[model samples]
Target: MPIKQSGKRLRVPWRKKLDENGLPLTLPTYMAYCAVAGALRPWNRLGAKTIVTLVTTDDFYFPLFAEAARYFSSQIWHPQRYHGNVLQCSDKNFRHEAEALRDERAILFASPSYQIQEDDRLLSDAVVSLGPRSARHAEAALRRAGLPITNESVELLLTEPWSRLSRAFQDRRDALQAIQRLRSLPKAIPPAASEAESPPSTPDPTLSDMHGFGSSLIEWGYDLAKDIADYKAGIIPWRDVENGVLISGPPGVGKTMFARVLANTCKVPIIYGSASRWQEAGALDEHLKAMRASFDESREKAPSILFIDEIDVFGNRGETDRHSAYMRAVITALLQLLDGFERRKGVVVLGACNYPDLLDSAIKRPGRLDRHIAVPLPDAAARRSILKRHSGVTLCSADYEVFDMATEGMSGADIERLVRDARRAARRQSERLNSLHILDNLRPLVKLPSAYVHSLAVHEAGHALVSHEVGYANVADIKISRWRVEGEYRALGCVEYDVGADRPRTRTFFENAIAVCLAGIAAEIEVFGSFSQGAAGDDAADLNRATELATAMVGAFGMGHTLAVEKFSPNAFARMRSSNPELRREIHNVLETELERAKSIIRLQRAAHQALVTRLVDVDQISGAEVAEIIRNHRRPTVSLAKPERRAAR
Candidate 1:
């Protein structure tokens, strides 16, 4: 296959090579095969001309080479003829065996990376670097081979390579058991940590850990948890409790989380299933067998939760689509075992799907997955609650209440990501987790229109120009983006500060930080006679940051009216400042001082400011070095970068 990358056509040479008969079956096998094949093209010619030997860095590629040799065992080395020593790993133990084969006019794969001097003779034939083991190369091979991979499992296979992947699966051909293990895990945790001497296993997730769920759905889940508890305790028969529920929601609303939590609450095991799991087996009979095995496992593990994700992928039988015949057969088999002659006894069925409308009508009939609940994206209140739930001590209720207004239309997934990203940013900064980190780390949702995009350029250009004027920090770069936050699309701007490690966190240092933060609004006042809410509209915006810095300067650093360190708490500070006019005046004076300083700088450097803004309006991004150069030279930016429409908008 020819893949076009960066204007070049690259050929991907891949064949199944050898993933059969007790050999590991995985993507790595194919990737390893690709590297070897690409290194030695025209397989037969290489075998005929010289004694082909692959000298490797790691012995991990031994099986890979053996499989390749077995596949291309042709001519004097015909596939059926050259059996065992077609490819021998020339390791320390097998050195004699490999040399013996070498003498007999056979190919011997050597370990030149280990001891090049000892195996110097083997390297003369051809020394090729094994580097085609890239996920991109392997994925192309997988697609051509028609190997089925789940959307979720693809990340685990590709992102976490070698150790985790090889441990999970060795090859894809005849890897039914490996596929089965991956299919059951709703969240695929890379299994590499188990062998690395980690801490003791923690307890499972319970009901309390789950949040942002609809009241009815959560209440139903809890009651079911209790009933399952009773059923397992022998206080009631399995038929007394509702047998199943169908939880439908958009992706990342935690559909599978419900089952895991409920199982934890009731102290029963949970087994995961999905249409893809059954469909992993290509043939109809094998698909049926896999489906039956999942059901049978649930039946034997009585009082267990059987959670089937992406249930809608089974598709509907009524529609006369091309795939109807096979699906109808699978659905019929599923329906029979779901409530068939052999009762499921104490199993609780929970079916999860992104689109409930796509599910088979029979799957949700009474006595099956009957109860249906729809989980929608969290609104303002729910988003606030979700933020608090995920943040732990990183943020408080008052902090969340402020953010609640800011994160109006975010989903449960988005909120979790917000907290996770904040933690990562905080770790990188070597600081304690703070609400500002969470707020600042939010990703841009969408690109903007022409009008707001121009304004963002002006706002960011101001910060970049003013930060350079201030000696506390230097502007690394400035960018404006069309940010789609909530349902609304608006322009947002950012200025990265390069604060040197040599700078001390003294009162002057913080005061400089405050001035840099205030530069945005100051520049706006200078250029447009007024600034937009882009400065201080939300709790996490520039105005808020400036205020926080000034507040910390006064109270935390003992720089203003009170020369006492008031340990910072965002909520407490907000409340204290609101109540105490004296403290408020102190913060206001500090802000006003920085504002006037920035405006004065803007007035003097108006040409540089306008030049940078014009360039930014054109390019949407500018480097700090170039920005400084522009300011230094006071040169007009080239008018070529902006579109005609953007120039008109400006």
Candidate 2:
């Protein structure tokens, strides 16, 4: 058997290449199979005892390899029948199976990996590794096959593996039909450009449909969209255009949607990928392969936008120890791709994450992902636009205004869910969608409390009252609400005030601000007879601000009792008593004295405080004007008497 005279000639059809669909193979597919076939022939000629070929490819193309093994099994030399020789199994199961069947002659189809276990080498006489096929490989194969497709079509097919092109074509047809249905709807925005069209020269109006439209969150996106449009129209040089932008924001703030709409507006194709999806593609090597493939596909469709969502998952080294080495390698690969992106003109990389700070410093540097834009929560006007877009036609302008007021800090996704919930509520009640239905739906979704509304009212009222009394003068508004179920954190209420544009504030101003901060806690104690955890957030924030102010006054501003400039860390005051026991006692006395002053002021304005709380509890919100009116009506008069004469007589 070892001799060359042991005649065995495997006559596989070397020049014939067919894709999974039984059509003439594209250049990449032909090259990939040819590589596999070529690797197997050498082992056959050497009279190998066993052979296993590990082909690394897109998950969609795994079936094509199984088909090729079957079609060529008869012509290829194998100890087992051609049908039974080709084995497709998961990497984990392959290890166990390879150990049990070491003597069997088979070709195993497994994901690509750089690390081959010792057991695998012991089980097979020969192993061949196949990487993803590149565009050049496809071009060469097409030339050899004498196919009649243009270079552009070849590029398009490169966006996907050869097996997926036919499937993608069918999906495109379905998508077009769906677009037709959407366009027929009442007031529906314009449909997105088909894949064949060039990038648009104007911004898509539907961008406004995204949440946080008027805010800075999407401002950069709009700018990018305009630049893309300009670039496509030949109005600007490609060098002037940005190569990549990082969109950082909270979840459901429309970061992913904004990328999609921007690409749509620019009329360019988009390739959507995510770190989670890449991680799910098998082992570390497979994940890396998938990441490279994603970028490669995006490049194949040049001038396309590559959107990578949840990019924070590939955090910087030292961020997490669980997958340190693996994720570091992933980040390194991504950095390389981003840096090389400049060479591929018309290609832009848009990465999104909730934790931009977690990304490596290298990725955020000037050459790669330099344009970091924050997609903040929607403001009032943006919220209004979001509600109007999601709500039914029956919702008038006034309804939108009301919703905007109600959904003060909600994200776009929250507004959309609220509208859908409201519609469901109306349907359940067998009634037309009305204000009551919307409000009812909102209560559960927002986690609006039926009981603690009064406490929240008093809490916010205290801040407003204290702010006005301290001459803040511009108490913009006071708002109260219960916990929102969909919100990230529980918010009881807030008092918005403007301190005016005054620089180098005096000690008195700092004291006033501290009092305003503590007023909520003080009010809860005064009105409810005990404090609740609702003041925990306010207390921590106010204490920190107040301590910083006290530290600055003593250290930086030289407002201490000794008239000497002494500097110390802000937290040093808390432990000052242990070192300079007397000085620490004095510092403690200062804050105690301020608290007493605040309590005294509250006592004096008890009537005004009660009025404000009552109004707040009744309406859940009040304007600065209403607070001022209550304070004015309940002002205590200044009474002058012969105090000096009385004291002399005594």
Best by lDDT: 1
lDDT of 2 by residue, 518-565 (tens): 777777777777667655454255555565566566555655575665
**Which stretches in model 2 have alpha-carbon errors above 4 Å?**
1-205, 281-286, 318-323, 341-344, 379-387, 393-411, 414-459, 469-473, 481-491, 500-502, 505-510, 522-533, 537-590, 603-620, 625-650
Across 1-650, the per-residue lDDT of candidate 1 in tens digits comes to 99433211112224344333223335555555555655565443423434556665332446555665444443223323344544544343455446545644344565644544445465345544443244454456457456665543444444443444455564433444554565565644334324222435655767776677788888887898888878768899879989888888888887877778888887888888888987997799999998888888988887788988888998889979898999999989888878988888888888989889988889999988888999777766677667766665445655544465456556788788888888766534424467888767764344468877777777788788777766534667787654456566433567787867886676667766777787888888887899986677677788898898888878777777767667778777887688778889989988898888778777877899899989998876798788888988983343221111112234
Clash count for each candidate, listed in order shown: 13, 3
Give the TM-scores of the predictions, in the order they appear.
Answer: 0.40, 0.53
Return the number of clashes found in candidate 2: 3
